[model samples]
Target: MPQFSLYEEEYHPSPLKRTWIEFRNSHIAVVGLVVLAGLLLFSLFAPFLAPYDPLAQNIDGLLIPPSWTVNGSISHLFGTDALGRDVFSRIIYGCRVTLGSSILLVLLAMLIGVTIGTVAGVMQGVRSSVINHLLDALMAIPTLLIAIIIVAIVGTGLVNSMWAITLALIPQFIHHTRSFVRAEMKKEYILASRLDGATNRQLFFNSILPNMIEMLVVQGTLALSIAVIDISALGFLNLGAQPPLPELGAILADGLDVAYLAPWNVALPGLTIFVMVLAINIVGDGLRSALRKRLVR
Candidate 1:
């Protein structure tokens, strides 16, 4: 029994031991997850914790250096924008816009892209041929440029902007998801499951989707980062998040003019964009690294 116990221990790890080993091997991934979680928590609690009304004007406090000075105050730690809105307050609120738009855009794009990609990748013959040609044409056009053009034509508002960005992202998602699905479809287990009387839905849910989940996770993270950055670029170009919404990109673009002096005006938004995008990218990197290690082990 003692010898058997040792053998069992070697053959099967306790859950805690498995988790500890995972943690030790994926330290950077853990840090990324922590940063991502922290930012998400901050965004969720912004309304309750913000010091001043993000939209309220305080010309008296405009662009004040962070307090602890004779004339300065701490109410607005990040200072104020041109209209005297509390920069700190607005920044906290600004995240709502950035993160919300990012999530919405990523989700919408993923749904459309993944569905099409699956259909295309699974079908061989005229179905895939037609889909592949269309995707190729769209891929040939520059995503950002096409996004800007579409936004300009459709008129600029949140809905229109989301549509434009979603359009920009659709091709990439289709390409990636199609490739992933196609590859998974060819795997022996998938073919075996199909031969063993699995329904289409079951094949997708139990076989294909489960296998592609890790790749999809990585794709979604990377896609969100790209979508957010693309949306911000459109905003900077004055196409998305039109005036009065406190968009991070427009704030930074406006900040560029006065960048010589009140650098924080732009810096605040720029930093927010940077950190949000950076958090997403970090998460993506971590996922990729973890997945690779998983493959190795």
Candidate 2:
């Protein structure tokens, strides 16, 4: 062992630093991060990046193939849709709608779920049991079916679709959080805090919440992928984004009619959705691994 002087100190990595280091070390995670960041930047700058208005119709250019194809123009690089909107431009703009709604849905679900789950976990007796049973019943239903039912009840639209998806997802977060909280409640440190006159609120806010951050982050990211899929599925079903809006799934749906003549229209949006969901899942997995290692250290 090395002798330490009064001024000497042992080094320990901060949480942020460790997290970054771990994330950077994961190749899949790094790639996912880069792709996601690029998409976010592209979405943010869609108005500037897109050469043409995504919604603008060019009737003369309808069914045009990609730029490299015989009848295609460089102006519509990824080709034109049935309505003659530039596929590339629509894709760029659609990113904002798809990612934005998914993120908002996740945030809402997390806020509501975590609060209810924590309360259910902390409280004793019949209330907790009732809450648990309710959550379990919700979870037993397929998320897509639940979303469809909610959407049917509330009517169809982008906002309503997201709300439906959010409702479907809440049970998952609540179950996860409740399990973690219940386990944490039985730990020795929690008992000691209680013995030291710490209020339930104080123990929760100060002690429990901090430890739950890693789990929440991982869950939130994984939820994002599912949310994206659900959003796209709803859009595909004509229950989201609607006509003239250029959402990814709606774009793909529109492309179906002219798919044979204009394959790029469908392919581009489908590929974008696939890449987006894949990146999110990869990042989520990386976070889970990296956070677990940090906890071990």
Candidate 3:
């Protein structure tokens, strides 16, 4: 036999690994990741990082401006609200209330939506059509409107509003997942798997579910952004988090009262929500692009 040099075989990263690598290559995505991480960290360590208690009143420091302002003090970096509570401290704690609750809401919605959607897609009969039609009808109504209606019926409160938001979000998830599953089912590979005598359950769990991961990740990010907005809106309307909770939307509502005297109060909380939603959208777009490239490969 002719002498041949032996070398290790080339290695290929998995689709998920490749998608992550691609996501990292996008500079905008990296910036979004950094900003989002910082917010999460700030919220996670708010107990230690907050200079003062979010709800602790300081009658003496009422309406104080930010430290940079002429009338401001270093003790309260972002200054005090009308109630004399530290603005910065309230914001830090608010992150947990706003973002944290949105995350849980999205997850619950996703679980219920994915389960029902998968079943609807696999069935592919009158039953499936009925389910899809129901979802379509629900989706026709704006999610915010649906949420508001639900809250009206359920009564105003943070937990109730979260549940209302979750219900509103479910239709969207079901519609997207159902479409994805149906499309995958029609592919040639799926047909081949059927010809090979694979069970419907096996085809779904093994073949279809694996391929749907990328799409689901994108959808989840989009849902998370929506969740944050909806939760904030409800809080602002007094249907979500209540007083003393340090929720961002509630803070904004309070800011409106003293906006003329201390504009930073409104501006800061509004800016925080804007930045958070922007970062989420950027990360979602990056994921979509990365996953699209992965599919093309």
lDDT of 2 by residue, 178-197 (tens): 99999999999999999999
Sort order, TM-score high to low: 2, 3, 1
Candidate 1 stretches greater than 4 Å from native: 1-7, 10-26, 68-72
Question: Each model's RMSD to truth, in Å?
Answer: 3.0, 2.7, 2.7
- Measured against the true structure, the TM-scores of the candidates, in listed sequence, are 0.89, 0.95, 0.94
Clashes of each: 0, 0, 0
**Model 2 error, position 129 (Å):** 1.7
Candidate 2 differs from the real structure by a C-alpha RMSD in angstroms, to one decimal, of 2.7
Model 3, 182-209: lDDT tens digits are 9988999999999999997898899988
lDDT of 1 at 210: 67
Better of 2 and 3 by TM-score: 2
Per lDDT, what order, best first? 3, 2, 1
In candidate 2, which residue ranges exceed 4 Å CA deviation? 1-8
Cα deviation of 126 in candidate 2 (Å)?
2.0
Residue 121 local lDDT, model 3: 83
lDDT of 3: 0.91
